[model samples]
Target: MSTRAPDRFHVSSAVVLCTPGAADRLVETLAEMPNVEVHAAEQGKIIIVIEGKSSGEMGATLAAISSLPDVMAANMVFEHAENLEEGLINGHRTDAA
Candidate 1:
């Protein structure tokens, strides 16, 4: 018999650069995507956070963002992965003995 590991949760943050005039519209568009959250926008720069089940999923989203109109660049700044089966208690991880 084979057992599969629990799904891993991925979190990533990116900085997107866009035309100053397009900031508002771009923010609205990005905010509508699943697992994407627009954190801040100012002077043509946008900060966003994304959550997904895997690195591929997050990379796909980043690619999509980079392809959007008026987006000059979407650079991933940070990433974190958490194993779902890791001694989690009430959504927080506990040290194992």
Candidate 2:
């Protein structure tokens, strides 16, 4: 029997660069997104983390951020995920051992 679950937990980070004087506005816009968290913003660069249930959702979120006004560019810096069920199975085994 298979123990692995099909669902995935996805997390990715991206750096969004805004126009010279648009950093504050871009930060405010990014903060309104439910799945995106702005970690830092300085000058014209903002660091953000995006989380979603699947990779497709993450990609879509990134694309949306890139399209937001005042955003000059958005580039992904990191991506990682794991199957929740699989992680639980392995965790239980370790605990029992």
Best by TM-score: 1
Task: Find the 10 residues in a row with the least total lDDT in model 1.
Answer: 88-97
Write the residue-wise lDDT of candidate 1 on 1-97 in tens digits. Answer: 2255667899999999998699999999999999999999999999999999999999999999999999999999999998777876555556983
Residue 80 lDDT (model 1): 100
Q: State TM-scores per candidate.
A: 0.86, 0.83
Among residues 3 or more apart in sequence or in different chains, the pairs in candidate 2 whose N, CA or C atoms overlap within 3 Å are none
After superposing candidate 1, which stretches have Cα over 4 Å from the reference?
88-97
Instruction: Please estimate how well model 1 matches the true structure, expressed as its whole-model Cα lDDT.
Output: 0.93
Model 1 steric clash total: 0
Best by lDDT: 1
Residue 83's lDDT in candidate 2 = 66
In terms of lDDT, the poorest run of 10 residues in model 2 is: 88-97
Give lDDT tens digits, candidate 2, residues 1-74. 45555567899999999999999888989999999999999989999999999888998998999898888899
